[model samples]
Target: MNQRPKLRSPPPSSAASSPSPPTSPNLNRDKAKTIIKMPRKSYIKPTLVLASLLTIFALYTFLFYTPPNYNNNSSNLLNLVNKFDTNNSNVNKVKIYMYDLPRRFTYGVIESYAAARGGGQVEKDALLKYPGNQHSAEWYLFSDLNRPSESRINSAVTRVMDPEDADLLYVPFFSSLSLVVNPIRSANANGPADRPTYNDEQMQEALMEWLEEQVYWKRNNGWDHVFICQDPNALYKVIDRVKNGVLLVSDFGRLGRNQASLVKDVILPYSHRINTYNGDIGVENRKSLLFFMGNRYRKEGGKIRDLLFQVLEKEMDVIIKHGTQSRESRRAATQGMHTSKFCLHPAGDTPSACRLFDAIVSLCIPVIVSDYIELPFEDVINYKNIAVFMDTTTAVKPGYLVKSLRRVSTERILELQKELKKVKRYFEYEDPNGTVKEIWRQVSSKLPLIKLMTNRDGLIRLQNSPQSCYKISLYIENLDYQEPATTYFGEKPRPAKLACTIISMS
Candidate 1:
């Protein structure tokens, strides 16, 4: 109570006593000065300012701007875009003029096969379908050429309707299929009078006859034409007739050095028969050390297959089977390749076969045994990285191949598997950038040489003389060409100047 009584109001300071009259003019003036001194509130926002500027600029552009005349500047625009756009550029494409051959040479062959196989009356679109065989490269190429231009925009070869604009001529004859479907007979063989059986020889003769009638074939003597004879015996009757053209082949095995050479021909990988392995590269799941499931007995360079079989059949951790190409056999082969560390790719009827591509797609390291083998796309693919090459002598030696494969470290096997996976797409025929495109690219690469040889056809004539015998030696080093043999010509030999080889006559 005493403390409360002691608490008294203190004297008011000047500010407290100066509670100025509310309506005073001086107070109002002071209030106005205080309000003016205070920092001004910013009504203008940065976002609003930017939006207003953009709107004005957009209006100005829409009112004043005009687009350039596309018709006048199209080529320049295309050049500029293509110069920058590497994906859709057609700079390296080869313009091809595919012959509109009679159906008897193309679809008729497939139709005959379908009838033979009990697949009656093939659909018009089903002409693209052919028997799944190593020789199907012809079918793939034909099918690719037949596709719409828009669909093949990125393809290495563009089908041009105008023959004058064509860089190369494509013969759409299904030579391989014709050989497979029709019976083999000598051209002079007799058949029933009522209905003469269509034979491979007759087909070959007919194809050559039709080809000879073509203006392009006559103009270039088939030097700029491309003929696919993948099978060893395909187009056998007319091999020499079409020798001047680019031969799409699996190998130079059955062909004579003069008929097909690496200089003028393109080697294509056989379409793989087995399912591709989709798993990552690893050794943990693979159980077998070596696997080979193909015909043990083969002819020519393929004789090594029998010898390798005799040696590898009894070896431990090896699965070598002499099996034909049945559905069950393919299944077995697929399983064997997928789980095997190394797949043996011994030569079959030819120096190379689909088995090598199968091994590649299966991600199985390939043990290539053919000495005379000329691989497809050798320019781009380094085979040594993904495959183990062995000469016939070394591979056939008992215990040599097995011992060598066993010596390969786990690290090395993994490396090979990785490389196989990387290159697997190149051998796949169905892939957009695979075998078909690569084959076209290979053909495109030969365009300059094809043009040069085509232009130089009748420019030079070498005559044989008794006084001075000129030896026209053309050597293709490291390829599977026969040794140079002397031929005493009664008259002048055809001009043998090739773009890829050095031809010298002395």
Candidate 2:
């Protein structure tokens, strides 16, 4: 009864307070005016980006980071390899094409006098009377230039047998041997004696005529041809004819005023008796301070020697022997240079002599006293470190030569000797790969000038027989005609740049 009474009396506020069921937002139409949603992303995408960053970091570490022990390992490896390395450096080689000259031109000189004069034997005996051998370079060039070789340290050049394919035309004329084959006229001769009676003149004329008739010679006017004129007087008779050829000369002493120049000619070295000075005598053990032993009376350059001899004769440390080269003198020279620290290399009749090379082999620093002295391999060896260059005017001054030598410090002398030891190979011919390689390297440098001349005159192609043969011409044909050049060469065609033989395809 009380419940019924209460229900009846329940107010509107009590009815609103009664519990209600949950309503959807869409059910409230007036309140649901607008809605907004957020986009979703995958968790795998962010993980992939993190993996890529780590991979890049690993690569950077590998490239830029070096362990502290890396230098130690590198030095150890280099030391191990250096023992076997000859240290010749990278040899710059040029392709050489050798012409098969008639035997009379190249080998005939030695054959003619092999029995009576014994070719180089007489020359070697004569040189043993002095500090160095005179005709050694001629022998070396002739023996090793085009001779077949099985293996050699990066030689500076290669040889080709074909004339049409050569960068330089080498005439194998033994010009120096020809001069020595005949008896030498006395220096004081009056009439016909003044002129050489040697057959070198005849050989030279024959060679020039043969060369002029060759296709290569006519193309360049013999400008690119190589001639070995070691003796200044060896080829003087017909120098005018071959003046334009590449002259390999010992010195310009015999050349007329306007004929010889460094621009057109190469200075060759006198062959030294390498056996005497080949061993390493201690530089510190050298007893004498200054030494000179050679001819005193010379024509052009010996005037300075005479002056030095007179001035230094009385000096305590200076030992001067003014005499001709005799058996006793030659033995004395070997001993003198071996024991001395400084050797006086004043010019003789020429501006250069074999003494300088002997001094180099002896490891005795050279006191070069000449005004216009030209040196062999000047491009490769720096003579300043191993030699003292005092012009004739300065060296002729009394006491100057000794004074300058004395002023040089012991450390400096030892340093110069060390440098001298390094370059001894450059002046030696026993190793076929040594000095000849250097000569070929220098000659190779002149190829640019030769090419320039050839290109300027449009004579780059060989004007031989019937076909145009050159690297450029061959390339044009390969591109345009696709024709093989085997018919012309009669062998597998080499690259046009290296083509050395010409044959007729027709």
Candidate 3:
């Protein structure tokens, strides 16, 4: 009886229970239907990306702002290394070159070098870094028979650069050999300070300035020696146009030399030399002084030589080189002049021009021959600083030169010595490296000087001597002081534009 009751209920299977639930409807049961699920994010991906970023960041943090690597082989990477390997071998550590004025030109070069023990202190103008003494210069650079640069002259002037290396090269313009300085910045072309752009114009102007120095080496009578017998108060323009004329003691020489051309440019018509301010002059000493300048003057084919043999006694304790002296003698002359208390500075044909830097090198006060002569750096440097200016017009006249000597006293001489000592404290040599470093900075930054790249046509490649060179002054303006960690040479002041004027010399 328990089993029989179940047979009646089996009648509805759906085919038996409910029409078999349509096949489609069964597929839509939702529970048994597979859901389109999104894949889970990969933990390895985000973790791996973060790990890679951290590793890179850490490595970068350690390497970049560290000390610049020195190629171990080149301890002094700045200067050239000789292949004593061969005497004729020519290899430059610094591709760029520099040239300085001859040692005979500046006594300060030797004194400064000797004092610094070879460039240990700082220079005022900062045009040079090394002691800039000639001996220190030659020791490491010109040690080999051939003279050369001490460091590469960087085109981009930024921070101070190292000394350049060289053996020798010709600088046709100045007609002398000089040194070159270039500092290679691993990151910046202009080390730390930005440099100005230079063009052919700048190069040409610089060359012109260098060329003007030829007036020094040229013989005094080169242009037939035009002398101006001028009145102290006379107009300067009156004699500006005198080309090839000689001025004699007679006033007629001044009146006739510039006829029609420079004849009447004077704002004032008269000349006088009676300054009441200057006090009494010693008669004997004045006469003696005039005799030293010129005992007799005679025109020899438009040239004049002082016939002062009787009075040309060597009183300066220095030697003189008259275009005919040995190299050693010439060097000695420079050193001698530097040691003297006063050096004669007979002005050239012109009245007040700027060629006095030469006189400064010797630490000797310039005993100027021209009253009209004015110094360029008159303020920063006092005439009283290192000079004994005399009026040439007054000295040239009757008994006037003698009177000038009377004005000078032992106290004045002592004062000159004090000033000379102060001057000696500073080193004044044409610092080729320092100047070029400045040039490099300018060229690297500005847009205009793109044309004048480092072309070594006139560069002198020489043997390298190991020595520290320049310490450049870095000028940073409006700099943010945050983190002083990252170094940067901001934009530099543009260099004065080079203006080229070609004067075809005949």
Instruction: Tell me the whole-model lDDT of each prediction, alpha carbons only.
Output: 0.82, 0.70, 0.32
Candidate 2 residue-wise lDDT at 192: 38
Error of 1 at 141 (Å): 1.0
Write down the TM-score of every candidate. Answer: 0.73, 0.68, 0.28
- The positional error of residue 33 in candidate 2, measured at the CA in angstroms, is 21
Model 3 regions more than 4 Å off: 1-325, 328-340, 349-359, 371-376, 424-427, 430-506
lDDT of 3 by residue, 1-506 (tens): 45554444435444444454446766666635455454566799889999999999999989885766678547654344332313423332212222344442233333333332323333542343433222132222222112332233222311212213321121211111112122223564333243322232333344435534644212221122222222321222323322222221112323443341222111111111111112121222221222112113334211112412222334232222243224564454454444444455554333431123334444445566654433322223466656766554443455443345546776776676466545432223124433223322222332221112111111211111111111111222234445332322233333211011111111
Q: Model 1, residue 152: displacement in angstroms?
A: 1.8
Candidate 1: the clashing residue pairs are none
lDDT for each residue of candidate 2 in 1-506, tens digit (9 for 90 to 100): 34554346746796589888888877775455433233456799889999999999999999999778988899998866553443532224456666677866765566554532333334432232211247656666656754664344456666666766577877767677777665444788544333323366788788777767888877776667777788767777778767666678888788864565676667777777524476663656688998888888888666777788878889878889976656687778888998899999998888988888888888989999877877987877889978988888888788777888888888898889889999888877676556666766666777777666556444424543236445446565767556543333445655553444332121
TM-score of 2: 0.68
Give the clash count for model 3.
Answer: 53
Candidate achieving the largest TM-score: 1
lDDT of 3 at 237: 36
lDDT of 1 by residue, 1-506 (tens): 35556667899998888776569888889999999999977867987999999999999999999989888699898867755545543466788999888988888887777665445574674644777887888888888888876677556778889899899999989888887684445899864454424577988898888878888887876788999988888888888888989999988888898788888889988899999899999999899999999888878777888888788889999999999989999999999999999999888877888899999999999999877789999999999999999888888888999999999999999999988888889999999888898999899888998888876663332232321232333232333657433333334443333222323211
Clash totals, every prediction: 0, 2, 53
